[model samples]
Target: MPDLASLVTVPALLASVFFFIAGSVGLVRMPDTLTRIHALTKADNIALGLLVVALLPQVGSIADAAKIVAVWIVVQISSGAAAQLMGEVALAERDAASSGPDQRGMAGGRDA
Candidate 1:
C-alpha cells in the first residue's frame, strides 16, 4: 500500500492543478478585465495554498516546509497588490470611457 504522504500529496497536487487550470480559463474567458482579475486571483491563491500544502509533507525538514509556506505568503501579498493596481487602472479607464466629453471640461475655459 502507498504511504500517508503519497495519499495526501497526490490529492492536494491534483486539486492544485485543477485550480490553476481554472484560473487560466478564467483569464481567457472572462468578459472584462476586472472579472478576469477576480477569477485569476481567487483561483490562483487557492492553487498556491494547495501546492504548498502538498509539498510540505514531502519536504526533508521543517525549515524546507517553512520556506515553502513563506513563498506562498509572499506570492499572496504581491499578487493581491498587483491585482488591486490593475483593477484600479481598469476602473479608471472604464469610467473615463463612460463619461461624456463635455464633462471633462475645456482646457482653456471660456475664451473672450
Candidate 2:
C-alpha cells in the first residue's frame, strides 16, 4: 500500500506540474502581454502554493508551515500587484503609440 505522505506528495507534485503546463500554454497562446501576465501569475501562484503545502507534511512542524505560508502570501501579493502595474503601463504605452506625434505648439499653434 502507498504511504500517506507519498500519496499527498504525489498528488501535490502532479497538480503543480499541471499548473506549470497551463501557465506555459497561456504564455504562448495569449494575444497580449497583459493576458500573458494573468495566465503566468495564476499558474505560478497555484504551483507554488501546492508545492509549499506538499512540503508541510515533510517538515512536520507548525512553525515551518507558517513560515512557508507567509512567504507564499508575500509572493502572491507582490506578483499580482506587479502584474497589474505592468498591465497598466502597457496599456498606457499602447494608447500613447496610437495617439501619434504631438502637434501642439507647432506651425504657429497656441502655446498657452
Per-model TM-score, in order, reads 0.88, 0.78
Clash pairs, model 2 backbone: none
Which candidate ranks first by lDDT, i.e. highest? 1
Per-model lDDT = 0.89, 0.81
Give residue 40's lDDT in candidate 1 (0 to 100). 99
lDDT measured at residue 1 in model 2 versus the true structure, 0 to 100: 34
- Among the numbered candidates, top TM-score falls to 1
Could you tell me how far off, in angstroms, the CA of residue 95 lies in candidate 2 after the best superposition? 1.5
Model 2: lDDT of residue 112:
25
**Deviation from truth (RMSD, Å), model 2:** 6.0
